[model samples]
Target: MKYISTRGSAAALDFEGVTLAGLASDGGLYIPESWPRFSDNEIAEMAGLPYAELAVRIMAPFTAGSLTEEELRGLCHAAYGSFAHDAVTPLVQFDQQHWLLELFHGPTLAFKDVALQLLGRLFENFLSRSDDHLTIVGATSGDTGSAAIDAVAGRERIDIFMLHPEGRVSEVQRRQMTTVLAPNVHNIAIDGSFDDAQAMVKRMFTDPSMATSHGGRFRITAVNSINWARLMAQVVYYFAAALQLGAPQRKIAFSVPTGNFGDVFAGYVAAQMGLPIERLIVATNVNDILHRALSSGDYSAGTVTPTAAPSMDIQVSSNFERLLFDAGGRDGAALAEQMRGFEASKAMQLTNAQREGASALFTSARVTPEEMVKAMRWASDHCGEIIDPHTAIGLYAACSMEIDAAMPIVTLATAHPAKFPDAVSEATGQHPELPARLGNLFEREERFDSLPGTYEAVRDYVAQRATESA
Candidate 1:
């Protein structure tokens, strides 16, 4: 299998190549050359397998030229073994119509651990075959920093530098990243929104001076959703949830609370791969750029509002470009021109093809704080479930969907309730206790740097400290 840049330019790469090269050289995200499809019998055979084995099967197509089945299986087992739950990503049924897919079982207590755990292993596996070392640069609103940091920290061949908006994240969210204290993990708290940090990270990927300052071996990769491998890893859970709920013979719907579009886009990939999906619900908080884009043709950015769900407080979603490129006829040049226009201004209207194609599979809703809290209360009172603010948005959206009574709607539980205990307590009148594994998180010594939100300041900081690849 080969990966092509969403933009018309950059050379095609195999799985390993794209895994190492996060963003395309021509300023586009990488996507598979074509969607890999499975027959009904093929998908049916995937039932009842363990999570590790299932991941190996679903990811085999994308990793064809890179990893053998045995190799991939070993990596999968090693990566998922650390999850607190045996199911890896367990599903909890609320009622006949609604369910929650718990994705915070891994070390970081966020959905990102599902992918970054395997991503860290992949980086180690690939780097073992060569002399090259990786300098991973990533930006996160909340969870991605901690998950990515936990994944790659202390690895001999990789050094990770993660940036997050300083005061925008919850106390648990911030400490999860700051308290790791790994020498190889460099955490930066930038004085801006997540979009500003994300823009700087993107700029670093293509900056000429960043490359020239270090030697020819200066290698920089990504841990964000901009990396195809990370997004590809996320696709397996959609299949896992659907197969359990009855798939191949039945269609399942998923509601994903996403700001960056990566998690929900994985569902779109599953549907493209012949998984029987009824719809992919794009759930957003007050920061509703994605909600506006899918509901109407308007894809515009506004000021980032600090929300209870800090992870969803993003204006510019990096992975939405992949959807636009695919749904808009895969005409890279045309999409590139369209993207350029959007970058110049902070807005663009989705084309007829893009709008129509997206509407066929996706429906979106924006949840206000009041509705979010109500959903949390409903879960507590009715279902005896304590949910984080992010999951509440998804559940509220799922309940609002006018779908068949027989159909099952799964809401992606993106984070642990303890991660946002204050918000959960305010809504449900119950303070969530941290799991035993993280009970002492607040007692750990924290370490990180504070920097102004400027491209040059961040660039110089990373450049001065980034290890030169050998």
Candidate 2:
């Protein structure tokens, strides 16, 4: 399967090329030239398969020409073998209508583990074929940094430099990234918001100076959702949840707590692949650029507001461009022009086509701190489940929507409650303890550096330390 950039200018790439090249050279995201659809029988055949087996079936189409089915299955099993649960991503019923898909079962205890674990292995497999070194530059709000770090730490032929906004993430979130002292892992605390760090990451991809620093053989890639492989792995869980809830004959709705838009866009990709999805609810916190854009066609970035849900404190939703490109008739040139304008002004209006296309299977809601806390309390009091703030926001939105009463809504439990103990404690009057598996996270020694949030600062830091390709 060939992947094409959202902007028309970049050469089309196969899955391996796209996996190694996170962002398109023309400042666009890569999407499959065409979505591979499954017949009803094909999707029905997927039911009851183990998570690893099911992953191979769903991802086989996308990984064509890069990995054999056996090779993909081996990677899937190896990646998921460390998950604490056999189900990998388990489902918990909250009530008659609402259920939670628990996705924090892996080593890092977040939904990102579902993909980054496999991504790290993919990097190892591909890089082993050649001596070319990969410098993975990524930006994270809370979860991505830790999950990505955990995945790639100590691996050969790879060095990861992850940047997070200093003092903006939860204590657990920060330590999860910083405590891992693997020589290949470099965590930088930037004095800015997630958007600033994300902007620098994106800029590094296009900056010629960055390429010059690494010399002839070094290539800079991404571990962020901008990577198609990461996003592609996320699509499997949607199928897992939907099939378990009776798909093919019955449609399922998912409520995703997303800040980067990658998680929910995976749902969009599942829907494109002919999964029987009734609706996808895009859940957001106080930084409601996604909510505003979906509801009123106003795609604009506002000032970052630090909240209990620090992960969602983002104004620029990077993956939103993928949706716009797909929904806006795949007119890359037009979308590129639109994006250029938005970049210059920090805002843009969604066209009629984009709005209409998105509204077909997508709905959105913005949750407030009060409502999020209320949901947390409701779950604890009524359902006997204590949830993290981000999951509570998704549950709040799921309850607020008026979907068919007979149909079930699954909220994506994005992180472990212990990761944000203070927020969970404040909301439900219950302090969550870290799982034994993550032993003494706070007590572990951490290594990282603080830098001003400038592209130049980040570029120089990475260039100085990143290994030159062999």
Pick by lDDT: which candidate is best? 2
Candidate 2: misplaced stretches above 4 Å? 467-470
Instruction: Evaluate model 2: give its lDDT.
Output: 0.94
* Whole-model lDDT per candidate: 0.94, 0.94
Q: lDDT tens string, model 2, 139-217?
A: 9999999999999999988999999999999999999999999988999999999999999999999998877755656
Tell me which residue pairs clash in candidate 2: none
Work out the TM-score per prediction: 0.99, 0.99
Q: Estimate, for each residue in 1-470, the C-alpha lDDT of model 1 and write its tens digit.
A: 99999997999999999999999999999999999999989999999989999999999999998999899999999999999999999999999899999999999899999999999999999999988878999999999999999999899878888999999999998999999987788899999999999999999999999778877565899999999999999999999999998888999999999999999999999999999999999999999999999998899999999999999999999999999999989999998899899999999999999999999999999999999999999999999999999999999999999999899999999999999989999899999998999869999999999999999999988887884423
For residue 313, give model 1's deviation from the true position in Å: 0.2
